[model samples]
Target: MTNETEVDVIDPVAQIESYTKKDFQLTRLPYDFLYGLRNNKFQYSQMQVVMADKASKEGVKSFKQLYKDYLATYHSDEQMLAVNYTEFDGQPFQLACGSYICHDDIALLNSNGIVEEICNHPVLPCVRLVNIDDNTEKLIIKYRKGYKWREITVDKEILASASKITSLAKYGIAVNSENAKGLVKYLTDIEDLNYNEIEEKNSVSRLGWINNHGFSPYVDGLVFDGEENFRTLFNSVKIKGQIENWIEIIKPIRAEKNICSRIMLAASFASVLVNPCDCLPFFVHLWGGTEAGKTVALMLATSVWADPTMGAYIRTFNSTAVAQELTASFVNSLPLVYDELQILKDKKSFDDMIYKLCEGIGRDRGAKNGGVQKIATWKNCILTSGEFPISSEKSGGGAVNRIIEIDCKDKKIFTNPSELVSEIKQNYGCAGAIFVKWLQQGDNIETVKHLRKDFYKKLVADSDVTDKQAMSASLILTADKLINEIFFNDDILLSVSEMQSILTTRASVDQNRRCYEFINDFVAVNYNKFNPEKDGYNGEIYGTVIEDRIYFIKSKFDAVLQENGFNAKAFLSWAVENKVAFTAEGRSSLTKRICGKVCRCVCVLSVEETAEDQLLNNEDLPFD
Candidate 1:
């Protein structure tokens, strides 16, 4: 053991140098570190020795000294940054920087901790204006160079490590190694000194209750987590003129010969009714010729709740289905209004969208960081306008219950659409809140349920629409009844007789039946694609025609069905059940000679005759 009183000194500089091989000055080393060098107990490593020696000898106690003298050593005193820009546009812009710099952005840089440079792999300023709530990581960051405070709430993972902290340069914050160490120290210091808990919730925008309370976006306790996209949406849902003004102008239109105006208005309120009535989403697709003014009807519907601008609440279908699903989740209880369904990516996908949108839950998606993304859910009616029917013969019968296709035929919906648009643009978003207020009132929900049930019964008894269709239509009718009674003094009641046109049933939505017809038509036109029995035909052989049966090459048949957007396995199974197809005795498909080649095939009755012919020849009828 070394002497307790005597100094057991070894070379301190040599110990640090041997451990790290870095030269460090000895101006600021404590005497204790030199004494502990004998037992390898030097607490200050070589890196710390170098950092302590090099740390600004001019100790910056206040933010002012640290910002101007120390921070400027790394970057120019006159730091120019981009000013006054939201991460996105068309929303209320609140810059997070304590003050936005109108001219060139001189970042006191770290003066207010708003326009900061954070430390990362390269030790650069990755984040700025680090606003935190208490000890929690509910961070709001400042961007732009102007005096305005446009703040965006960021995730805490931004502060995790070198790579994560570096990604904050996306907000136009200048990042370099200047004053990085001092700024990093300042961030750690402020975290302990300042502790104010701000109320930031991930509240989604909707028509009904916000934050589990009644429907007031403003005066609500929770500050939305800086998703100003929803701000753009909610800002448009402002109350302009009086509710009486809206009713005065729209009541006459509701009474017009065209049932479209009434249906559109009812469907607008029907979105909020979906949750209250406890039903899945349904579509009210208004379709017609180009001159039928379906867009005008859509505008009227959108104006009932928000700004009637074309791209505002009423958007085009010129986007991906993923975008639409996110939008649906965003506007949970509001009308998911889409204009020009003709511009959708494809009709087949749009046909599938009805079932998807009605399901009220988004598909589980994988995140880039090898994690699951949040699945979105919503219950609301979808309003669509297009030149042709949204759902066609290719659609399944179940989709029929999800969609109520309105045919405007050749009739023009409005005499003066331009004038109506002008009036609505000024006086909108007045009635949606009023309608919701009545629904949210104490004990009024039972009335809505009873009224919906009564409407459902009447619709089923009177119209040929299916049970699901009748149930969906009843919600619309219930909304229409309630809104008329509450808002318009029951003056603009939508007639059940007029609305029944939407529920009027005619042809089948059965995809299997349509596939059968499509196959018959396809075979007639594509006979040259088939092989002949003579073995002298010149072309690609899709199948072999033998007597009354066509033996299709299995691969070619599946490819054809897939190309035309039909499930091959599903169609073949349906065909077998209906006796339109013939399978091998012990197998699902035929192993037969097709086009003079022994291969797997799907045997189907020719367009001219069916295999039901064999059942009649059996002579096994009990009645006989």
Candidate 2:
């Protein structure tokens, strides 16, 4: 036999070639040969045959056993095989390395696999494996570090290239290292894994699992047996509360004499369940004086679904319309509660927000890759509170009609508002779940639709409420009636009479009514200026009281329109069409002799005309 030093000096590749010429049953070289040749390590190559021959003489059962023996002799202790065991579907399995990730049959292996079908593990945890229709697959890895999640999709064949591995490492992942080697070995050894092909489907807007039939993980009441696909994936959180405790605490408030507050809370709960009903999503605003418990009413409504705290379920109106749209999209079918509309002091922003939210869809955008971004959409109720009504001089008929303004009658709707708030704080979110449970017991969609339609027709016939305004009231009525029957055992009913009173009164003061009211109030406040006898110095009587007709100077009338945020030309045209004001020549401004002076003015015929004709003209306005 040659000396050990001389054997180390021998060319292992030449020796292997000579041995292949002999009658040896070796079909191919071992996997370690490429590594040894790259490292210029003749020692590892020299030991391969000795280890294989020794294993064969010792009656090794398989090539894996021989490979293990070779690793034990040459590799260090840290490089030795380390196995971890886990069970999937009640089947025992072992993961021989740490870097490998096997989710079913598809294993993402490291660069050491030296195979065409393997892919390097991504740096980030987010990975999308898509199997196309042509029997080919694509792996897209999104890296979320300092910036937003960015995508890098590649084919399976590119995984074996050194340049591909280097490029991936630049984005961050270890390649050709000890960790990669172990990962390769572990992935290659997994046995009998089952994997289902991932097919592309329509993306859900919310960040949780949902089925095709609208059954969602976030939704409380749903019973269907089908696989849920997480189009916009998110982890579920464990909520802590007892539904029984909540129902008991909320019973008194629900049974209280404040029908507006009770209806607001019930309608908020019913909003989530009304997705199956064919009606547009609408808003409810609790409006009253400073101490009228409007905030408490909004809190009661918010307590149905989540914490009534400042930022939990009840959010401030200090954000932009874009932010509101995003929040609505994030919550999806849940109720969105906004408190203190006074915080949104920007009149234009507030007006835009009201219109955009009632529209029920977000603005379309373009993605970075030049494709149209997924549009965000939601259908849900928006509950708001303010010291004054939501429909103001700046609001149009469309915005006014979409909201049901419930005026809180009393300064204190609850005897102990603090206790009610505390009870709700501890026991919130359960009533919403209970409401959902009751809704899921049977199909109530047709009943809800019928009740809404019937109520809509009744309100339209009984009063001057617009169709959209009547629709909002109808939803509230349906919710209150259903909730009283289901949860309250029909003990208290939010009667159609009460709703009729509230809606008719609220509808009577819509945009035109408010505008007319604003004109009267302005005239009353500036009566001294309009009266030539009171002020003593007058070039032309701006607003002169002549007999019964109140004549307003055209310039002063336009100034009032500008001060009240009404479009001057549009209001003038509207006033002319409605006969609220008229000119001598049927124009906006007309020269007339008022109190012995020629002046350009718009003549208000009577105070009653402003109120009556404005309503008639506003009868066909669309509030959708």
Task: Name model 1 segments beyond 4 Å from true.
Answer: 1-152, 156-167, 172-211, 216-222, 368-370, 397-401, 461-464, 490-500, 504-507, 526-556, 590-624
RMSD of 1: 13.7
Worst 10 residues of 2 by lDDT: 229-238
Report every candidate's CA lDDT.
Answer: 0.63, 0.57
Per-residue lDDT of candidate 1, residues 1-624 (tens digit):
223233335454443333321222222122223323323323323323333333323331221223223323433323312221111112232222222221122233444434443432111112223222122344555434344435455555554443454455566444434643433343333333233322234332333444346554432443444345666766676677878888887877876846777887888898887887788888999999997889999999988888999777777888777878888887888889888987875677866888888888999999877799868888888999999888876677777668988888968999888889899888888898777777777888788999999988887774566777877788888888877787776466766666566673533455665676677667778787764554567777777777778777888888887878678888878878777788988776788775557888888877543432333332321111
* Candidate 2 lDDT for residue 425: 74
**Candidate 1 whole-model C-alpha lDDT, 0 to 1:** 0.63
User: What TM-score would each prediction reach against the true structure?
Assistant: 0.68, 0.63
Global Cα RMSD, each model: 13.7, 11.2
Q: Write the per-residue lDDT of candidate 2 for residues 279-381, one digit (tens) a residue.
A: 6768888877777777777877777666676655567788777778887775656667788888866666656677788777899999754688668777778
What are the runs in model 2 whose C-alpha is more than 4 Å off? 1-211, 218-239, 287-299, 307-309, 417-419, 425-428, 437-442, 504-510, 528-556, 584-586, 593-600, 606-624
